[model samples]
Target: MVLLTLWLTWAAASADTTKFDVQPFKINLGSEIPRLHALVNNTRLPSKALYGVGQDKGIELDFLAELRREWLEVFDWEAQEAELNRFTQYTAEIEGLTVHFVHEKSADPDAIPLILLHGWPGSFQEFAPIIKPLTTPTENVSFTVVVPSLPGFVFSSPPPRANWTVDDTARIFNVLMTEVLGYKTYALHGTDWGSVVGYSMYGSFNTTVRAAHFVFLPFFGPTPEEIAADNITLSDVEKVAENKGNLFVSLGLAYRDEQTQKPNDIGLALYDNPVGQLAWIGSKMKLWSDPRAGTPPSVLNTTAILTSVSLYALTSSFLTSVWIYASNPNGFSTTYSQAPTDAPMLFSQFEYNIIFYPEEYVKQTTKNLVSYKVHDFGGHFPGLDNPPALIEDIREIAAVFVR
Candidate 1:
């Protein structure tokens, strides 16, 4: 009886350990692409805006209509899928959920291990522009880039419980890096909701998450009184950035309320509706991006926009992805303790990101801030808006913080 029990215990242990094994994945949304085309073909766009085709009123009807034309007549999913597959992709079961990620290892024997995180309406694809450059830099520095889809975002499974928070997602990501991949330490860069998780990881897994770079933060910026108390100086450019930020807070966050209060409504409404998804996500792709995105050097083109929506629609993850807002009510208005903690932190402040947190305010959140970069260009999605600039900022951070 003792011998039989020992054999059964070993078998059970083997099965449990194998469950978290990473498996190769490719973005083959084959038949789903056809269904998407049909949905776009049949979608009826809303009537032109009363104010005409302009962003001041919502997504311009003319712009969205052109996008619709492009989606049905010009966009190519297989081409985009091929581009995404150029790098290695994989999925692993972690904490009872299947996690999808892009893992690109550098040839450099001493390459730094790094994980890139994405936020709402964005996926692992957001880091596509920087993945190859980071993993295979011309200079001596290189990284093993690991970009994971946030829970319920693209190919990753949704949060198993409605009460799930970014803190929970942070815990699983730590497992991805330290436990599954067997990395003693790693670094991270995040934007949008990714920054929220990145902050959590930096605080909770400091021994393993050695450093972080963020383009956005979950904390509110300093108020006028706080700025006066600090006697901080602001440049003319900083003044303009602050004004734009005010415009965003005053006029731009109604979507936040809807998503946080009634995620199910918008999620279900746009879940299978390709055009609806396009209009919803495509508008933000343009609005939140730099005004100069269509010019040379910018990667925020119509095809990129379409590919983002395709990832959400093809995977049928729109509903689950929006649950993030409802799951964490205090996401944006977090009150950090004055006491700074965690590994050295780095920041990249883009000119057009909706909110502007001055270096003074950012420093309050962490004790060991190593760098803060201010860019004249780029917006919320800096990886797409300005890849070279973002890459440089990250590399500089790694040189200082990563061993």
Candidate 2:
């Protein structure tokens, strides 16, 4: 019986060890440009429009119309594709699916291996600004950055099966880092859905995932009793964040709910309609970001938002991407586990994020909670909203692993 158990364990580990091919990839959007242009130009807006307070009533027609014009005229897919190609991009077959990623190695011999995970409505482009900086040797630390597109988003192929969850992504990414890339152990940093995937990896592969940093936690949030027990004190900013979080849960989660319950319905509706895709994704980009950071107030750059939308529209991945919610219907609702993780964990609390959890709340969910930080600026998309601050925070997190 003991021998059989040992044999099964060895076989499972060996299955994970199956080495796969990694091939260089480049982004090409030339053929899709004409179709994208037609879609943008043909989009019609309501002649009589009513505006509400800050995305409460959905994306304003004027804002989306302006974005549509820019998508047709100003945004250059060729230039963006060229920029993307500057970094080393590759795709590897893992579990019969193609996983696309950006692998930027540092010149510093002692640089740490770091895997960055991005969430929905986001691709590896989130880390574009920080990648070079992270790879450059700083006085404190440097990292060989590996940013992977989530399965079914952007360049990566769609999920092979219908029920692909973040947990499955976690396992495949672990294989990419350890078995494919030859990293014995690596550190992880993630935001939004990326946090869920990174958390799974941290829990499931503790020996290989040395430490982790997250801007989002799992479903286990602090209850009122736990909050009272901790005797937690909140600053005025934190109080506002809490209110915003409450508002988001009450009013702002319709998109999440739709995706979780009936992804295919909206997915099929928006699959070929770039205008629909824009309204669906662009609203979140505008509402979830820091208003002061970009042009057009609270929204991201027109080109950036268009680029993101174009990726989905061009690739026909809107359906597959939304399916993540379906696969993990209880992800945001169910507590993954109460048992603390052995890996060192760090978290960042951004004021404008959709969900806000106090440090006390985070502590209850983590075992070796090394550091908890509160940022005055930045929101859900920190990589775009506040890259410098996010980069610095990641550096601080990386220091824990190096030491």
Candidate 3:
């Protein structure tokens, strides 16, 4: 693994420039689209059903029907691309790979730098609302927020070779922050799969990252009590978190299993069938959403969820990311050998997301532990669901380290 990092086995990719660009930079609706109008009209979402009135109720029977109609009829790739391109985006080669990212900097030159990392089936679009507040804190946080489409996702190029892993990505990011932006230190935040990316940033180059925060705390080790007691303490908590992954043994590790094993097969499916893609991601968005919370605000809007995911999905990088998983099963697994001084780290255990009891995980890791706060609001995709609460927590925790 170290060798892969030392000598870039990864190949540098030149841009995949296409001459035929979509005018208006949006996907064009085909001539046949109007025919699907019947389905679109047939699928009407009733006002109050399934979780009701505007909150994330399970796509009302009517809405689902509409989703079917719209999806079958009006789902336009160009529209989403236009919306995506509206955000300032750029791609650059780093560490032998094409990396795509968005850098929304606060107008204030003095604002701190914060890197927001996204997870699997997710893209930087998740950070849209949260970015403004972070970039303008007080008034706003006033930080330059950089959201990157991890290598292999969307605009970014694929992993140079089969050996690239999270550590390499973190190293490349270190270059992005200090070398690219010239920030001696910056706060880092990530969710879901990105928890690993953000965490690895500290581990890969502890000296560079000032602080790191994660909405999803990923650890594949024993709990702290287990470590201290020197006995089997079990995970000690149950998160309703079930996915197509947990549906079966291999399924439980579906993301991991696929990433490690058959990433291409999964990616091919996501690309071939939009419905297949929706069911795969939509199911989880539904599961993570609290029926009590009404319609799980942050994670997705079933159809809109596809936007962020499809951004990555259409690129075919989803398969590459899966392969990364297949390659590095223990990518985020923290052990003694590759430990760093615990930088200030905060892990918000969304009431609904998995909580392996991070405080316990903290005790086991070898970092100069700072603080860890388990928040009550927002699970998995905190950026969209609970921006205000996330804003407050980030402000409080980030203040301690930024200074």
lDDT of 1 by residue, 352-396 (tens): 887888998888788888898888888888899899999999997
Q: How well does each candidate superpose onto the true structure, as a TM-score?
A: 0.92, 0.91, 0.73
Worst 10 residues of 2 by lDDT: 9-18
User: What would the per-residue lDDT of candidate 3 be over residues 183-209, giving only the tens digit for each residue?
Assistant: 677888888778777877867777777
**Alpha-carbon local distance difference test for all models:** 0.83, 0.81, 0.59
Per-residue lDDT of candidate 2, residues 170-246 (tens digit):
99999888887777778999888898899889888888898898888766455445556878888877776676677
Task: Indicate which candidate wins on lDDT.
Answer: 1
Better of 2 and 3 by lDDT: 2
lDDT of 1 at 17: 31
146 in model 2: Cα distance from truth in Å? 0.8
What are the runs in model 1 whose C-alpha is more than 4 Å off? 1-19, 224-229, 338-342
Which scores higher on TM-score, 2 or 3?
A: 2
Worst 10 residues of 1 by lDDT: 8-17
Candidate 1 has what TM-score?
A: 0.92
